[model samples]
Target: MTKRTLYLFGSAAPPVFDIARVIEEAQARGWDVCLGLTPAAAEWLADGLDGLAALTGHPVRSRYKRPGEPDVWPTADAILVAPATFNTVNAWALGLTDRFVVGVVAEGIGKNIPIAAMPCVNAAYVRHRAFERSVQELREMGVTVLYGEGGFVPNQPGRREPYPWDRALDAVDGLAPAAE
Candidate 1:
């Protein structure tokens, strides 16, 4: 069987979350993982960019490619936005494609690609009215949002809770076949 391609999009959250573990888990589950980062996330992980690229055998992308530039990565069968922040979620819901990560997500939705977003915002941010609406909008668009009690519950301010990376992976695994 051909391996499924998974695009993993990460945002700047707690610096302690180990993204390598997510990659390893995906690989073990028979997925070919590609890493995409929000600008802040890329900067936070700048020191390990090369190693991550080497691990995935693809360039870690944070910016839009120049005109006529050949796309370097394979088309994704699934997309996971782990550690998604409040800003990213709201922007994505509002159809803002200003950044590479959000652009891919917006396009992925248009293409009917399966997407799982695991948000890591704090309780304070979760209380924002936009957050609820954004999650609902994304769900209406067929994106699987891993939130609420069983998924990613908002943590207390200035406190970090364990992120449920496995649940995000499972959501992708359980997605309906890509729309033809």
Candidate 2:
């Protein structure tokens, strides 16, 4: 089975529930799945990690270090940054991995792991020069940023629709040759 590590960033609201579903689908197709949550996001999605773990049958991680638990750090074939919030996106684009989610993404880049970033934010923020610059920087550094229409939610005012799952899966498939 292809190992898939889903890095879930919840720096904002709306929870990336759709992205969660995509990861779940990937898991069903035999990809080993794991999740990383941001501190702010942990508050937003109460029990969400448990639900994701239940669906994926893998532990959801939110910390950068667990001194005695290295086994929890499963290797990954690809990394998906669903609902990439402004804070997380900007931080990552600038090489700031102080948080768990961003840190995993940094590791992926270091190891040449394929990465897909799905940006979720308001039109105003999306139009911001700084934000646009950050996205460009990410692309320039070889991160594939999935483009899609965004919407407003009660908790997540700038939530985008789910990214194209088929394409994401295709990316994962392209990562390796078939096992004979």
Candidate 3:
């Protein structure tokens, strides 16, 4: 059987700095990982882009190719949007595709692809009405959102708590598990 592919879409969040380790974890779980990033996230990772591409053996795309261009990455069996920021969450819920990362994830819903999101927001952002609504909207659309107590609990603003990457990966594995 073919190896399951995982498309890891990232936004501009601090945890995105640890993407290399996350990719390694996914690969260790028998996933053929592909990396995609929001424009800001791409800029934040600019220095290590080539190394990341080499690690995944695929181009790290931050924007859509022009018309008639071929796709550089394989179709994903499942998509995980980790370290999802408040902006990303709200935009995705509102069906905004202004960014590449948001575009794929929004379309993933219609494609019936198994999708999961682990948001890396702070306690302050959580207070915004949109955050909860966005989470609810995503859940209503069948997304396995890893948030709240068992998932990515929001930390206080100005504080950088460690993100639970393992929980994010576990959600993805549940969505589309690897070979036995």
Off by over 4 Å in 3: none
> TM-score of model 3 relative to the true fold?
0.98
Please identify model 1 stretches exceeding 4 Å from their true place: 176-180
Work out the TM-score per prediction: 0.95, 0.78, 0.98
Ranking by TM-score: 3, 1, 2
Rank list by lDDT: 3, 1, 2
RMSD versus native structure for model 2: 4.1
Query: Best candidate, TM-score-wise?
Result: 3
How many residue pairs clash (N, CA or C atoms closer than 3 angstroms) in each of the candidate models, in the order given? 0, 0, 0
Alpha carbon lDDT at 71, candidate 1: 95
Task: Please give the distance, in angstroms, between residue 15's alpha carbon in candidate 1 and its true position after superposition.
Answer: 6.4
In Å, residue 134's CA in model 2 sits off its true spot by 1.0
What are the per-residue Cα lDDT tens digits for candidate 1 across 1-180?
A: 578899999999983258888898888887888999999999999999999999888899999999999999999999999889999999999999999999999999999888999898999998899999999999999888999977899989999877888888888888734332
- How many collisions between residues are there in candidate 1? 0
lDDT of 3 by residue, 95-114 (tens): 99988899999999999999
Identify the leading candidate in terms of lDDT.
3
Off by over 4 Å in 2: 1-11, 67-71, 148-170, 173-180
Residue 173, candidate 2: Cα error in Å is 4.1
